[model samples]
Target chain A: MILEYKFEYLSNNNTLVNFLTNIADASDMKFEITKEKNEINFYVDADEEAMSSFASTIASDLPMSVFLQNTAVSLVQEMPPSNIQADKTKQFNLPFCPKCLQKAESAESSDYYNPFTTCPMCCDTKDIKEFIVSFGDEIKRTDAYKEVFEDLASRIHQGLGVRFKTLSGTFIFEKLENLQEDKNQKDIKLLCTNLANISNVVVAKKAEIVALACIEKPQMDFRINELYKSKNIIQAKRLSVRYPNDLILYLLSKELRALGIDFLSYKNEGSYDINVDFENFDAKESLKIPKLKILEQNRALVLESENYDKKFMQVFESLKEKNKAHFMVLLYENSLLQKRILNFYTSSRDDDNVSYYAKDLEGFLDVLNYRLPKSIQEVFEDIQKEESGERLLKNYKNKYPDSIKTALEFDLSVLKNASIVSFWKIAESILGFKNSILDNASLSLLEKGPRIDYKLFESARIYNKEFNYIKLIQSGMSFRLAGVDERTISLGYIESYAHFISNIADEVNKEMELEGISLSGDIFADERISHYVHKSIGKNFKIFYNKDFVIQTRF
Target chain B: MNILILGIGNILFQDEGIGAHFVHYMDEKYEYISQKNSVTIVDGGTLAQRLIPLIVRYDYLIVVDCIEAYDSEPGDVYFFDFENAPDEINWQGSAHEVEMLQTLNMIRMNGDLPPSRVLGVIPKRIDDDTAFELSEEIIAAADTMEQTVIKHLESLDVSLRERNPQITISAMAQISFKREIVNDSGI
Candidate 1:
């Protein structure tokens, strides 16, 4: 008797289907496999022993993909006519499977210690070679791939920065302890080998861990634990952490693990002690199904688009040209929320026209002007002239001796020329807090804190046309002056800003009848900001973010 | 009538900045009649909604920017009324285009939008690295754009007088490029 089993696999991508087909071909059982829509049907000459063995093998080793929504297996009555054909499924560029990893470590195998080694069950080696060739000349093949990685690991262990090309791009890696104190560490990322390694460094939730281990391994910012914080390896309270995505990094991570080093700090572009020059391969861009996309970064909560906009498709079909339209909003930490506009005819996707509008703080002040007392103006000018917060506070303390009292009584026009940075600088001084990096100051408030609502910043008009950033900053300052904790003040500011931005977006969408909103920029990566923004927006309009690139693309 | 000529584009990209370059070109070469009708030229840059207060105050608006049209060749110039935009014309290619259109639509919804027309050209080189030079095709097309704008202004009872010698777009590009290089070097 012949028996059939059908398995329903969700996802449009061919990764799971390819994996199943490859695994079936490797099995000794005489089985026919066919797919109809999302279901994969298998027919076997019912040898119970062979069928049970094959089923157990599949159950033990199924490839993990975020796109695989659900799977179900059930016995079927009938099988379609056998139509065996050549396997033409596109090979996914994914991490090595358990079998491939075993082969890579075995000395008897041809793929032993080969960084470029891949099988039908894994990624396409030919595509990898082609991408590497695109970087430069032909690759110099060698049997000493493992030796090279070991040497690189040794150098990194010796506290030297080494540059090497990953599947994504070139990066420089160094021990966190070796990083210079004065060096800018804003863009630095902590790369670990696995979940256990990452957990040792930072405090991460289960969702965050799952996100890091996912196929599209994104760099996530997490608060450093007490142990790492006391070590003072990095200055920031929160560190961007990520797991190794490429083979070379994976191998290097193993070698580093042997040396008792679990993680390293890295940045995309920098001067390094050693350059590991080799043919660089590129990873095929993965299909990103955002779990929790806040602005541009994808986190743990899966946010999937339900369906294509029918109205947009209708407009697209009516149009005669193959031109692209971009609706982008860029939100940087210290800079103004910049809205870039460009609609142009292009021969190809590469022909992207770029432009920028340059406006100084004076330009912003001209649009949102406010009046202040003469005394406050003098104090603001003096504080602005001081180079550091310490100096600013010292000068003001010597001059007035009761500057905080004055700050509490009346609104100051100091914010006229203030960006986010200057706002933090002035606020820190008045609140008796030491100067901290903007990211650290913000992250410090991630902990649960008291909720305090201060008076809204006094604006000239209630519904101002432009974003009243100055007033928002002033509101935070008021809370701080009113003896609220720093954490509470930070939470308050984030909430206020989120509400303000969401309201503006809602108003614009209502007025323009736009299909959706597009949010970009790195500042949106902050946990509180992302949470509040999404909560405030609340399904009123579809939110679009970058799928190909992270919110903050390095280099 | 209060007439406003707003030039928008990013100068960093090669031909993407043709609209901005054209405004500078117009400013240098001609002086328009402003007695009867107040005419203002603004290098709007990549700004969209931020210019709402300034844009709506005018009685008539002329926008100069890069545009994409179906079945159009590089350097193809297009002129159309904003209210009655052609089906073949698309302003969804880049961020600023969508934003500028959205800004106009928002204003229209509030009944504050003025009678507006867009004078745009198909750019030849926008993907190239930072450069101020316009492509030869776009440079030639600018003449057609200039003449059209002049004719429209004339219809509004405004005339242009040649106040200075004709300054080539290339010369304007050279000046802008030099200024950028200096600023970058922090000299």
Candidate 2:
């Protein structure tokens, strides 16, 4: 038997003939194929049994039944109905379009498809029973990704998204349970890829968003490649590749490299997308650091897709334990919600970790440049302000004056015979010149023994639990007094000492705002005054010179 | 030639102190070089500014330090002549109060810098640490660094004679070398 068939598509004919030849060779049959412009003819010389089997295989494998109407006269006269009719009638009992009563078209191929399957004239599918029935009871069975995947395709067509591939396709998707789970993925991936002429790219962070291809035309990929090459970016072509998910990651890696941040993917089984070690990071590479979660020893960042619906706060909560000392960086998402969440966390936890919902890649970079140093500087300033020990000593000095009066008097009596030069000198010497000798070390309570000489301040108020007289004397010594130590002890010095003691009483009263401890009313105040009394010969009355008399009465 | 081998670095920071380590190595291993030749080996420590006059007084100044390799691998040794290196290459980061390149440039501006060449190695670890230890990679490259300096000195027509090899290295060899006289008249 001899069989001949003509094919208008040379590619289809070549593929069909090649397949048939392999089959015929196994069956010990001979075949010839001849080609012309957009035409190819196949001739098969075979026995009846071989010819029958060959026709059966072609009928099943080639989808040739669709064109049976056109091939009826030239080839087989007794042709089966077009497979389009067979396929439609077997799948759905009702007509696809109730208005036009439209059936599956014979000439339609996968190349010819409609995202909107309803006839354009009707502009409504209310009358389509099969269309409505398919979605009626089984609407919940529709895969959630169908709409989003379609949106991604549209975004590519509108020049708003880049198409690339990753290890898990372009997206990181949770497995959805559905009747058509496998078929739906194939359809969506195919449709989105064909629509954009590039595989859809999965974007999780602001950096990846910046890496999105904004090219206006199909040829623009090459232009981007050229541009990247001129800029000495070695991964430009990989980043510009139309298909595959690694391109966006590759582009982001380059941008991070410029910022001295090494961008890496999850090496272990983990929820986060990227991890960066800040130890090797060059601070001078850029001014800001983006939203970063500093771990105990390392740092990481997680970027969610713009369509993410999971509770991001919950993820951050877990991250806090791992990064107690670090900041949490949320990508540009709901800004108001991010602020509310960050405010709550900071207030409740007493951690100033920031949640930066960057408006764009540039904004994210800016925060990183500014926040790192600012945070470090703030820590240093806090340390500087902790001079609590010094403040405590000053409080003691202001609260108790009578406690040191006796000691001050004793020191003066010893100095009375040395010399008489300046009154300020005697006053300073009576104050024990503690400010000149003690260092910052001497002021610290950690050192054993009294910081100041106990001979200078004799009252227990100086050594009381709330007041350490030693620290007071040491702190007093910390003050600067120039040329006072050089002057000899004189009446002028004694006068200054009395004046200094009275001034201390006035200053302490003003500072402490004591309710009842008046110089005249307090028991210790009278004793302190009487200690300074000295006999004097006077015409009218016996004149006693005390600290108050030396200071108030200028004789 | 009157030669000064200045080693600069922070001795407290592990690998960043490689320059000081190289000086100790040179002082002990090649003591004859300094004793025989007019070579002065100074432990510059982290103070590059204090060595400005020493840079001007020497006929030939050789600096040994650790370098930030930038794009290159760690332990990679590089030699740069002050008068003939690329401008960008001189911007290598330093662990000192002032970077080595900036110090050299200052002396250059003064118009009295001796012919200077920096022999440096990219350290494998410049991390935070207090130990004076070196990374294995840098320790392995130390001999090559010594040879590189020797070859540069040879090119400058300076010769070194061996000392009595029987004499053991001493603790005093670790000390920084300074001229006894500060007056320029002695030079």
Candidate 3:
């Protein structure tokens, strides 16, 4: 097995260099330093026994060192069983490991320390020597002779590993084989800057290259990663731990893919990892199944995660009114409260039209395999229930709250006694106008003292706000005429209000145009009628106002 | 050379009305400058579209307005060749109009838009007040801007000769005609 370790120390401090130097001077072990200023890498060659001992000593001692900031230790390649002349020379002696002796005596013990016997006690192993020398020959034994070794060597024998600093924080690992498999699970990959030294390429036989690749690409392939590198690794790690579920979502996507299930994975699609077709097992033929949409939601690890009720409701409401499916499958990890939430939502809805499957990955896969009912339509009797026109309009309004004009029309259509004032009030609410738009336009006309109400000249008009005074008067008169006789509401005021409304609407349209919002047909039609009415009623005000066509003032 | 002085700004915003006020001030005190057959002073007044034809027609155009071009003292005056002005010109248009840059670009798209110089003053206050009067800093900047505009006119070989007593105020006023008609049909 090949052993690789990366230990990072502050460049300003020479403690790491001094420590490695001291070890090399004290032993016959030859180590090469690939030093680039602050970073000093040690590449040592030794027999299996010596390497294991050295690895164990370093793994136990280095992690606690103030100067040893970070270290990656991996066994590059397993030494051929009998290649070492020293090991072959000692083959005749009993390979005595006191730890293996005690371990074999336990009920869990699979094997005792013997050259020929594979030790089940040390760890499930084919060879007794492989058990004692797993990490690095670091474990101490009460043998007659005192022999010291590094724990990292035995750990490497157990698995290929890496230790490195990432933007997210220190990524310490004991194994890195399934990384290539994990990378293939998602289309998105992390771009680790410092980890560039380790590439994603999987090479064979060359332990050095493999070790380097493992170090550089751990971020790309591991569950322990982040969206972007933090300037301070420590802070990033602390923050990352807070939202570990977000980190898990990235991993869960891979886990789901590993299950070999056919599902469409959508990135951040309404806070879910995937949308699986429960009824249709085949990708090509899944669309044929009329009702098979299942959103797979993954909850974060925190005690209180984002509420899915509102978000799920909004999503269910916006489903292209034509979509056949409406169901959610929530995947939770170690969350006991999630079951209660699922139950709460399931029982809260009046119709209970939505089917839900909530559980952890293992439980979810079990449900997917043995429990899920086929054809969601069979599960939901109200699948074909058509929404009323008013309900549809309400849903539309909910979806587009910024569309105030449409909402106003919807409100007016539903009102019991919709008067002109009510209509204007609706319009004002939609336009975000605080004061009555009609009143402001009309009162602005009274700015010039005691002017003839009909011939409201420019000097008499107030220009404080954007409104046409004449159209306001016309709208006011039209409102009065709805209830009062024309004998009371003079034609001049009516004409003035008509023009005012027309001018204000046109101005509003122009303003909306600048903002790149094309007004809907209903709003456009309302404004257009005002403009056309004013245009057709030209000069008729003179006949009505001069005679005082005397009517009572509604105000 | 037919020289046109176009002032542009939205009067709804207090100090933004500086351009409109400058044009009106020039119309009163420097109407004498119009004695030169080629000189025309226009109050563009929040209407970027209104200045398009005049911009393309004039041989030389000088624009006056409140500009937030650089981080400087509020009343600092800046005069520069409009063609060489920074692309990051801080001129926001009113809700009903295109920006000044867009209007100028439209003219250039049609053909050449005459040699132009933009005389700008950084305003101290641009509060959301629909008042006609300018702040004191703006008023002071306007005085300095007047001198700079005079210098620019001199460089263009145009001088503000004293008005002939014979030239009636109405005649001088006629040159200030608003191209866009106001629809006050009832009056």
lDDT of each: 0.57, 0.35, 0.35
* Candidate 2 DockQ, CA atoms: 0.02
Worst 10 residues of 3 chain B by lDDT: B178-187
lDDT tens digits by residue: candidate 2, A188-286: 211112212222222123222222221100100111224324544232222222211222233333333343322121211223221211122222321
Better by TM-score, candidate 3 or 2: 3
Candidate 3 RMSD computed on C-alpha atoms after optimal superposition onto the true structure: 29.5
List the TM-score for candidate 3's chain B.
0.76
Error of 3 at A378 (Å): 44
DockQ of 3: 0.03
lDDT of 1 by residue, B149-181 (tens): 999999899898876566887777544311211
Compose the digit string of candidate 3's lDDT tens values, residues A223-284. Answer: 22232223221111111111111111222222323332111111211221112111112232
| Candidate number 1, chain A TM-score | 0.57
lDDT per residue (tens digit) for residues A1-555 in model 1: 355655554333455556666666778556666766446666765567777788877765555544333455656656666544434654455666656666777889887777667766555554343112111343444447788778778888988787876765678888877865445555457787657767678888766776666554556667788788788776676676777766678788888888888788887777787665444344344322232332323232222222122343443344332222221212121122343211111111122111221232121111121222234444455444532323334434464456566455445544442233344444554554443324433555343222222122345442322332333333343334334456555555556555545545544444344344444444455566667667756556554443322332222
Interface RMSD of 2: 20.8
For all predictions, the C-alpha RMSD in Å is 25.0, 34.9, 29.5
Which 10 consecutive residues of model 3 chain A have the lowest summed lDDT? A542-551
True contacts kept of each: 0.00, 0.00, 0.00
Q: In terms of TM-score, how similar is model 3 to the real structure?
A: 0.26
